[model samples]
Target: MVSITISAAKRTSLAKDLPATLNFPDKTVDTLTVSDVKSAFAAKYPQFYPSRQKISLKGDNKLLADEATLASVGLTDGAELAVKDLGAQISWTTVFVIEYIGPLVVHPLMYHFPSVFYRTTVEHSLLQKYVYAMVMLHFLKREYESLFVHRYSHGTMPFAYVFRNSFHYHVLGGVALAYAAYSPTYANTSSYIVGTIRDDPKFLMGGALVWLWAEVSNLKTHVTLRDLRPAGTKTRAIPYGYGFNKITCPNYFFEIVGWLVVCVMTGSYAAWFFLITGTYMMALWAMKKHRNYKKEFGKAYPKRNIMIPFIW
Candidate 1:
């Protein structure tokens, strides 16, 4: 038997015995999979189940797979597994949908919802749906994109983050944007074609064009990045295309531009605030990615703007 030391980042009821120490049959005699370890773990400590536990090497970001052997992951007689109670695990796509779908469904409802549900009567004009369409496009695109486009080294997220992210995106962002834009006072401007360029035509036409263009660019960039990893390899390479020449994160740039157009089209302070806050958050992430790329590629990578072109 091999004795291993397990340290949990957050203490759980499993600590009823002071410290976490367990012994498993030596793999040479008996092969021990992560599943077997988890089963033994659950049997030892009834508080945690195999599904609720996230077992990893100490100080490592990667989580052990169920079928992985104790020895395959480099765990030996004295190796330490930093265990954590993740409560439950969920797919990134599911988490994102739960977070965004509420807003996507609710924001449009606010436009035509009865006053009984909301404090004031919510109504919209002909052009209001343009902004609504943009909003829906943003979230719906995120859902399909997550499912079909994006890939993560770790496909699951912590349980608490799922609920927290849902609350932030749905309750705070979705409901608030809906309430602000669907209020009794929210009105829309009338428009003509190209001649009256400064009116609703400009807002909807320009916004829709920018939104569509940005969406296309973002998808293409994601595809390019995804292809770099290929079918069975984990190698990563720099992505190029669209605004890649000027920014390491062209996807983020397109994302910001897409929402900025929504804000302009809606002409709502709430929309503006959402766009501003979202852009700021994106900027921070972009800068972080920029630094990461520089560190990763070093002199081989370009010295360019992070998110915005020429003005990051």
Candidate 2:
């Protein structure tokens, strides 16, 4: 048997490793000694046991008594013992998303298309175009500053930020479409549609109204659902929870509707393209968040689908 000291917080974790076997002196039983553990670790992994620190012989998620306690319990020095490790594993979905979906597929396709399409002036008022440009700039800045650029404890990349950033485009596109309709820029235009070549003021108005309504709902609902610790103000917690939790990602849901409205108002194929893209991305994020909540809260999490009502 071995005498080992265990760390306070890690006791619960190391207890899980007790069932695994460890190295011991030759001619001894399958079990390890306290000295044998120290010696084996020092020789094999110099960095792990640089100095004598507390160690434990865990078995089946329980901490075994030290040598004295084991001796009292009638366990021999060579008796076999098991140990296990209780570290969380990486999810395969996270790997697939960061490696292929976020970087190679969704990001490049959805983000780059707008840059190419809006590269030139297409008869929309210069002022309106500039406003759209500002919105895009803000969207990019928020993603890079608040989400993408942050570091995390785990060895994972920033796909969540990318998904959130994409949602911004859906809403902003509708806003720009609608705002341009009444603005001095495109009011007197002879033709707005590309192929049909006609003035369509209703398209702009419809897109604008939807975008405005969606934004208001998103901001309000998000603020209502955020989680706050005692240190956090209720106001702060509500908004924060709305942004992070799966229970209330209303912003993403409304964003799709915003784009749909933009398409109906402006009659632009580009608008529909954005709607489809936003829907695909939001659905993935929502599902991932929902699974995480279920794992975290078990039966306590509020019953709700990603975006839709009970039907979804």
Candidate 3:
């Protein structure tokens, strides 16, 4: 009898075995079968080819050998064959959801819940819950750099340096806002009614406007503006062709104004603290980016001030 050889395709789970070709001597086996191959793998490596192993044979592009048919091939001992592991591949989509999508999308949406409670409650538990939610959102925000923004982008100074400075102010100010909104310490001690909230409609409207404007701007600047820079191209050199450069970082401008509105509406010292800190940090970062753009593009860059276009 002549030698029969078996081979498996490369770059698959089976490819780890070098030169997949196996030889069958003249008289040991009648014919190769899927069960015989699976049994060989099981006897050699039980954990990898457990009883659950599924093996099928195909010839002339047609399937062959149910369990019963496999048992009937009747090949002799030491008959050589190839086996492939058909276990499911790792789910990259699940990984993407956990690593990138969940924190950026899911967590923020859930964290905004404090304001909702503050809207409904005049009770102590409600006040405590609002503060607790704010604290949770604050801690959660530390992860934002890793998840929301790109890892690296060149500017005059390190992005982390600028971001961390701003982040510190942002969180502190936010904590103050939450404390002022829920805590009555300032309200009890304040000399002027203007310094403490007393359920004024104008302040509430301003706060709503600020918060709503920020949300809209966030969607536009981060999501909708859609800078189509090619892969590996430096984004700093790109002008704000979306036209927002008319007033640099209109999104950030709204963010500052929103916190101010919150401060007035809540009559909370904390809100003012946050507004001051967040705006200062953002102003620094925006100025750096603006300068970098002008330097990179020269006269081609639009004529615009750092924060306000015509006035400041």
Candidate 4:
């Protein structure tokens, strides 16, 4: 037999006078599992329900999986196991809905419907209307994908940070787009769209194709990634097809393409700013994801560029 220690937070309902060590068979039993160990505790103490129980080797922050053996997680004769409550858990879908809907719903109102009673005297132009449509379309696509095309396993950011991210996307982005892209003067131009062709046929025809194709590619990449994993498991596979062959994060690549197309069409500082900053952040994230993929998959995964194709 072996003895193990169980620890919990003080002042809780856990029996304070319980002995520090509990006996267990020295030989590995075929039926003995981490879930069984936790179940024994829950049978004795109602507060330690198996679902609510989070056990880990002392000094390690990661929770041990239920299917894992006690010894596999480093439990031994004199080992200490820390038990704590996970408290409450929220689904990623719920969090994503709040994050995407704020910007998608609230930001468009400023561009589409403005009151004469408001303090800002912003007049609309054809370019302004076009920019408004594009911005609305971008955010609507994000909302749709978040709701349908993405599946998260088991990870969470703090609720406070989720609120902050929503504000950053909608409130900050809305003010910038409304102030710059919706200017009244951009539409009063007669510049040649192509090298010699006038009447803005270049952007109307060429840019529309590029922008929409990029958006669709981005959506396809997201759906491909979602199908790689089942509902609530932390398993992933190498992405195949569509955008995965050239770069590690083709979704970010296509998103950058969409923003650059907007800059070409509108020639607005806001569009350029979005393109540059978004590129910088996405590059950082792509590199991070690339490194993480390498670390996780090791020799089994293929080498790929971070965000760009061969140039990167």
Top candidate by lDDT:
1
Q: After aligning candidate 2 to the native by TM-score, how far in Å is the CA of 72 from where it should be?
A: 25
Cα deviation at 297, candidate 3, in Å, is 0.5
- Model 3 residue 202 CA deviation (Å) reads 6.2
Q: Write the per-residue lDDT of candidate 3 for residues 81-191, one digit (tens) a residue.
A: 333444432222222223333323433332344345345323333323333343344334334423443223321232234434444433454333444454433232334
Per-model clash counts, in order, read 0, 17, 4, 0
**Candidate 1, residues 29-140: lDDT per residue as tens digits?**
1367776777777887777777677888888858888778777887777677777787767777778778878888887677667475556554455456676777778788
Q: Model 3, residue 185: displacement in angstroms?
A: 4.9
Better of 2 and 4 by lDDT: 4
Off by over 4 Å in 4: 1-55, 62-67, 77-79, 83-89, 116-123, 185-201
TM-score, predicted candidate 2 vs. hidden true structure = 0.42
TM-score for each predicted model, relative to the true structure: 0.75, 0.42, 0.45, 0.75
**Which pairs in model 1 have colliding backbones?**
none
Cα lDDT listed for each candidate: 0.72, 0.43, 0.45, 0.69
Instruction: Summarize candidate 2's per-residue lDDT along 145-255 as a digit string, tens digits.
Output: 233232222232344444555343534343333333323333234244333323434544445666667655654553344223222222222223443343446667765
Q: Which stretches of candidate 2 lie over 4 Å from their true place?
A: 1-122, 125-203, 221-248
For residues 10-32, write the lDDT of model 4, one tens digit per residue.
Answer: 33455464435555674353334
Q: Rank the candidates by TM-score, best first.
A: 1, 4, 3, 2
Worst 10 residues of 3 by lDDT: 150-159
Query: Model 1 Cα RMSD, Å?
Result: 5.0
- Candidate 1, TM-score vs. the true structure? 0.75
The whole-model C-alpha lDDT of candidate 4 against the native structure comes to 0.69
